[model samples]
Target: MESGPAIFAGAAFTLFGAALLLWTGVRARQGEPVALGVAPRAAVALTTLFGACFLLLGIWCFGRL
Candidate 1:
């Protein structure tokens, strides 16, 4: 596997997860629910999972490099 691809994928996931969390925060501050589709807890859980995956992938990529 190429370290470049892994790094890029990890970065993408991290960015997406961060964006989701930030969006949720903004919505919550405005008195809106954290999730627009699913339950707020579910959305937060997914976001947390994605963030963890991204962090692990990034660490692995760095080690490979």
Candidate 2:
């Protein structure tokens, strides 16, 4: 349960989330569908999930430290 791993995870997740959001935005502007039968809501949900994971990891890491 070392804080190092949690911190790394947090950073990675945050970066991933940021990238996803950015990509989604670009795709949206291009008027491309993210997935078949999937709407903008789905993308928002995915972004939220990633953000939550990052937040949880960050809290865990800070708590450990």
Candidate 3:
């Protein structure tokens, strides 16, 4: 409920998503197949969507400040 906690949570989520996406990028470049038990292309798509969602959620949290 506090601003500080909210900001921390948002930052954590944003960082996690960014890291996940970055890993995906590396894997794709290496031509590795399957991520999270799925196809490479699907993995990329899911990670992209989840990463965007994380960014949006973080922005929403920050906006409350």
Q: Report how far off residue 58 is in candidate 2 (Å).
A: 5.2
What are the lDDT figures for the candidates, one per model?
0.68, 0.66, 0.79
Candidate 3: misplaced stretches above 4 Å?
A: 34-36
Instruction: Predict model 3's lDDT versus the native.
Output: 0.79
lDDT (tens digit, per residue) of candidate 3 on 5-60: 88897888778777777777888889886376787788888888897788778777
RMSD to truth, every model: 2.9, 3.2, 1.8
Candidates sorted on TM-score, descending = 3, 2, 1
* Candidate 2 segments whose C-alpha is farther than 4 A from its true place: 40-65
Instruction: Please give the TM-score that candidate 3 achieves against the real structure.
Output: 0.79
Residue-pair clashes, model 2: 0
Quickly count the clashes in candidate 3. Answer: 0
Off by over 4 Å in 1: 36-64
| Number of the predicted model whose TM-score against the real structure is largest | 3
Clashes of each: 0, 0, 0
TM-score of each: 0.57, 0.58, 0.79
lDDT of 2 by residue, 1-65 (tens): 57778678767765766667676667767877755677776875676577566656655555666
